[model samples]
Target: MNHKYIAFETIVIKEIRRFARIWLQTLVPPAMMIGLYFVIFGNLVGRRIGEMGGYQYMEFIVPGLIMMSVIQNSYSNVVSSFFSHKFQHSIEELLVSPVPNYVILCGFVAGGMARGLGVGIIVTLMSLFFVDLAIQNLAITIAVVLLTSIVFSLAGFINALFANSFDDISIVPTFVLTPLIYLGGVFYSVELLPPFWKFVSGLNPIFYMVNTFRYGILGTSDVDIVWAFLILLLFITLLYICCIVLLRRGTGLRS
Candidate 1:
């Protein structure tokens, strides 16, 4: 095999195996959390919350929960995995090798997508245990899910590049990612929000993601579904360009 191909294959495979080797950390906990959310929020609190957009609260929020797992896991996978390589100084080995930066970037992003999509699938299956799902549009469902994964994976790559310490790896997820996901129409419809907050929430990227997927699943949405796909594609391309530039410049790669 060509050296670049070998490196790409090795790096991607290593990333995949890393998660597989620790299924407990990578997979089980998220699935269990999904189950808990269904029980606590969907069954209990959701009953009091009543119907949203014509569906039960549990059904209403399933798309958001799935999108949330997809976003968090995808982003976390690349940030932690790539940053670990940097921390161990192994990135230097690849940087000095013949592998193109693009290959390296794709390999890690591929790994992140794998973890993200894996979690989404697991969450979706778990959601079935709570209520029957109605997938209104298959194409929209897959497109939005894939786009959400790609965007967040790139976000994770950028964060990993900027991260200097273990704590640095978490700042984006803690401060930025969490708030965005929560306020992204997970529990309440934006229609019920104050006019000012409604306009502000419109700017939330996750809102489009969850809304588009919700439209696909339940045939109900707050935003134009086409706009959601366009927004996600725009972010994906922009983020990919940024990650490529950072890899070429070796930003934060050296001590």
Candidate 2:
């Protein structure tokens, strides 16, 4: 058990250092882009859009923008990092070693979480420059953010394992992530959508996550926040178990 923990710690440390070493690329650029969005969308455009859900448009969008950053960075970090290891054949070394598969999953997922949370913090501070940001509930907010990061990290790892080519990895973000995020109650309330479209949008998991986080911070949400957290927790648990099982079986690692 000691040996297992040591191995897990070593892999996690290596990944954290790898991402920290590339802070300029992985962390800073997202902060900059998000800052620009805050300037344009929240400052300039939001004024025209006016208040949303009894909050200033700028304030209302902050949580969604943060969640958006969390989701994208978390997913991209694991997919790119793990896929690089496999492409370079370094992952073969880890597989050949005695380290357990769950630890490997945790190590990679931790790296993604670190990078995602890092970017989220920076974006949160960046929001302070735009509006008087406030936390309506600290516990629920942090839990949702952490759970959302874990879910996406697991999803990214799955995507990496199944990626036959680099293009396959990008397809989900492009086709799935992008559309779902744009419609994830970021810019407008679901009530504003037509009845059929509202139901269609509800099917997007990102909606639950974004709304839940929004509820935590702004005290408003389109969906029940409890249901949102439960759905996210269910996905995280299922994804974690499935990922461990798949890795232990060398689903794509052997190839």
Candidate 3:
């Protein structure tokens, strides 16, 4: 038991250090890019647009943007880190060791969560410069962000398990994740969407995440909070199970 805990701790620390060592590449860039979004979208265009969802446009978008940072960083950190291990064949050593698959998975996910939540805190602080934020529901706010990060972190692990090359890792983020985020009610409310598009947005998993986070901040949401949480939990369960199964099967680890 102690050995498994030690292994888990070691892997988590290694993953954290790997990104911390490259702070310029991993951390600085996301903060800078999100800062740019605040400047362009929140400050400049937001003035002309005025209010959205009964709040100032800048305020309305802040939660979504923060959630966005968390999602992207969490997903990218795990996918890239795990894939690198696979690429260098170090993952095989870990797999062959006495470490349990669940420990390995949890370690990587925790590291990803660290990066994701770290960037989230940075971005939240940055958002303070653009608009005032008061937590409407502290528990809900924290819960959604944590769960959302875990979901993406697990997702990134799964992506890495199946990834054949560097190119394969980027494919899901570019073509799939980004599109979902934009359409997920980040910049605008689903209420503004026409009937058909509103129904379509309901199908997007990210839609629930963004809205739930928004609700946490603003005390308002387009979707029911209970249902949104259920969806997030569902994703986490499915992804975690999938990752464990893949690890046992040595999906991409076996050459």
Candidate 4:
């Protein structure tokens, strides 16, 4: 194997092991937290709301919740892992190595993807306990999930690149990500929103992601699935370019 492949694989393995060794923090909480969303939001509150988009409210939220889990986990894994290395001053070790910048970026992004997909799978399995999920299009479902993971993973890397402290890594998720997910039609549909609010919700990119995944799972959607996908790809390209630029500049790593 080439040295670049070796370096990439090593970083990937290291990141995977780092999170796997702390399963309680990395994996278990998402499962339990999403379980509560199902029990409280899906079973308890959803019962009062009846059908959303012609399906049980619980059923309607499943795809969104799964997407939520994926977005959070993928972003968190890269941000925290990379920031931790920065904090420890160990990132310089990689910087001094012969590994290319894209290789380094890919390794971290792949690690993020692994954890994101892992949590998504776990949440999907747990969701089955609440409602039966039927995939309207398996290809779209997989493609959206994969693309969403890559987008957030790249975003997380950018966040990490500019992060100067541990708190910086967290600010985006708490203030930005959480709000986007909640207002992204996770618990309700945009069609139910009034005209003005519906237009407003359309501005949130997460809205597209949740609706696309929902269409894949339930065969129902308020947004055009093709447009949702195109928007997703567009964001992925933008974020990837931003990450590459930051990496090449050695923005946060050199300091």
Please report the candidate that would top TM-score against the real structure: 3
Query: How much is the lDDT of residue 120 in candidate 3?
Result: 96
Give the clash count for model 2: 0
RMSD (Å) per prediction? 1.3, 1.3, 0.8, 0.9
186, model 3: CA deviation in Å?
0.5
The 10-residue segment of model 1 with minimum total lDDT is 246-255
lDDT of 2 at 14: 83
TM-score of 2: 0.96
Candidate 1 segments exceeding 4 Å error: 1-6
- Residue pairs clashing in model 1 are none
The CA root-mean-square deviation of candidate 1, after full C-alpha superposition on the true structure, stands at 1.3
lDDT of 2 by residue, 145-223 (tens): 9999999999999999988788988999999998899999877788789999999988989999999999989988999
Model 4 ranges off by over 4 Å: none
1-255: candidate 4 lDDT, tens digit per residue: 899999999999999999999999999999899999999999999999999989999999999999999999999999999999999999989999998999999999999999999999999999988898889999999999999999999999999999999899999999999999999999998988999999999999999999999988998888999999999999988998888899898899875
Candidate 3 TM-score to native: 0.98
Listed in order, each prediction's TM-score against the native is 0.96, 0.96, 0.98, 0.98
Q: What's the CA error at residue 109 for candidate 4, in Å?
A: 0.7
Determine which window of 10 residues in candidate 4 has minimal summed lDDT: 246-255
Q: Model 4, residue 161: what's the lDDT?
A: 91
